[model samples]
Target: MELTVDERWDLIDKISKQTITFGRYSHTLKDAIAEITVKPLTGIPIAIAVMYGFWSFFGAFAGFFTDGFFVKIFDEHWLPWLQKVFPGEGGFLYYILVGDPTADNCFEAFGMLTSGLFVAIGVVLPAIIAFYLFLIIMEDSGYLPRLAVLIDTILHKIGLHGFAIVPIVLSLGCNVPAVTATRTLETKKQRFMMATLLAIFIPCGAQLGMMIEIIPGYVGFVMLYLLIGFFVTGFVLNKIIPGRSPEILMDVPPYRMPTVRNIGRKMWMRVKGFLFVAIPFVMLGVLLVNVLYWWGVIDWLADILEPVLSAWFGVPKETVGPLLAAFLRKDLAIAQLSAIEMTTYQLITSVVLINLYFPCVATFAMILKEGKEGGCKSAPIFLLGSLATLVATVFLFGGLLHLIWIILGVA
Candidate 1:
């Protein structure tokens, strides 16, 4: 005996009524919070407030560790001992290991053991810790899913739906896994577009951490500018790219107090990866830069690109080396830039360009792999073309930002 659809629903309603009960109250605390966080009017502002708090805390927390502790220990004790032990007043090995040994700070020294370790442990690690802590809290509390829901309409305007937020969030951790996460999207177009945007706009945790340490007061402004660039680039891509963005269909989990053990475990894993992966790359970058400098190749390239680097980007000619290093590791690239002693405007422009230039080697390979597996067999050509376009776009954007700053008398 088949029941009518109305009868089926009526029976299910009766079953639910019998099975479920709430003591007097109609709603729980979680329900009330969800009601506010999923709404259009209040959700976006709350999201912004939360993000601002995250960064604010990140800046302070990292600064406390860096200036209050790491810098003091390294500069006052470790660096001096290392310098004394490896005293080579003007030798080639000395220059490579401890750059400009007499500089006031490790960052300025640009040494393998000094600047390299200082950047990884002193500067970047603290910021990474802060970011992961906040990220874990949000993830376990279920705020991220609601934030995604709240931004669904806005995302549609940018050629992606709320579902794309998963990869976007993941990209903040590292772009390689973010690229791999693109497989979750249904369409090839979305996968390609998201992968492209992630590579161009999102600064991974390590890069952001180092930027916060190096740029000091201007890190917030630089980040805001990059975010604006992300949205504008997305809007333009939506207009140019020929595809329809699918609507989001996601199940939001219930809010709960995050487990301390889980958060610690996750943070440890991420920090461990950063320590092992990022430190080697940073040390390699220092070695590579010193080698290139000794060989005079950096000077030759700087001379060749002086027209573009200096006249166009408003940065020093030596920025060519950092720009090249950005492809291998963005944190190292930013670390390299910190040693250059440029004006605030130049630093901001260089940071923006490095973010928009290209993905690190790992992410680049992941993009190619994902593109091929996702059926875009011409992924290599497409990535190269996208990279070229990004470089041109960033250069223009950087110049415009510098011009605006100058017009406002801030430069």
Candidate 2:
């Protein structure tokens, strides 16, 4: 009456399955509760507080240079020499080298260029460094996995899962790295979904830093609007796209404080990478826009784009200059907005539009890389979807604000 070998194995398999259920069922529920609570409540708040503290300190440090030190540089050397060297010859070179100094458009002066650099180096750089440092610390310390687990439910609604946090969070520092971080996602669908969201809605450090400059006295309110936009657009994307949220099996690396050496090296590498890659694009964007303007191509292009930009978005024709730069670098677009005068609504809209605008060259490359790596045959969907979202958001928000203005009468 002894069982055969096959019968014995079947008995073992059944017992194993039951044993697994008995052993792991409680652990699963406990882990779920722990991950979710940490992500939305405590984890997110800690991240925000860390962000505020880092920025507050970084701003004070950057302000010293931007307000005091860079001012001296402009006053002492850059402005006087540029004026002497360029000297009253009203040509394109004069205009490019020394932007209208008198705060008027027609005159050739060094103020705009100086102001732009100070904004770029003194303000943007410090914030960028500090922000990137915080991100690296979070990433290496392994809190990111819990963050992913915590937000999995919300992210799932958008065809992604908790792991998408890596890219979305990094997008705050820079879309380029955020896009690259998509490599951590297992499936092509997840990467594409996350990448599309990152490009359309996430403002990089430069963009946010620029908004800090121009948003003017209501930064808090503008930020709240942006947060609302992110969640709304993300929620809509979840409903519209047909896909299951990928399994969230992130590796929770051990929670240890990031070492000083490791943190310094990480920050240095990120800063160096930013400068090497981003600065050239910024300078080139500046050069290209100036050349295009000088040659009248920019004007022609702006004329063609004017109706859509002005009527729909309520942005001026001059915005086309910054939009052109946006394709090269998202930060540059935001930084460029500072040169122009915009109402608070216009400022917020411009920030949102620029954020939701075209992906940078780096992000485009990352998208292509991810497509290749993830075996996604339908990669173009991300690009198209992102563009659609950006256009829709701009128009929708623009219309809403226009109605609000009509109702409110600009106070």
Best by lDDT: 1
Give the runs in model 2 whose Cα sits over 4 Å from its true position: 1-48, 75-77, 101-116
What C-alpha lDDT, on a 0 to 100 scale, does residue 264 get in candidate 2? Answer: 88
Ten residues in a row with the worst lDDT in model 2?
Answer: 103-112
- Report lDDT per candidate: 0.83, 0.68
Off by over 4 Å in 1: 1-25, 409-411
Position 306, candidate 1: lDDT: 95
**For residues 181-226, could you state the per-residue lDDT of candidate 2 as single tens digits?**
8877776556666777777667777766656655646555655666
**Candidate 1 on 1-411: residue-level lDDT in tens?**
999999999999999999998777678888988888878788778888997898788878988998899999988887888778887867889898988867777877777888889888988888788878988898899988888887787788887888788788878878988889888777766777888888888899888878877777787787778778888888887788776777757898988899999998999899888888877988888888888888999999999999987776778898888888887788878878877868888888888888888788889888778767755666775677567758766776888887876788866
**Error of model 2, residue 357, in angstroms:** 1.3
* Clash count for each candidate, listed in order shown: 0, 1
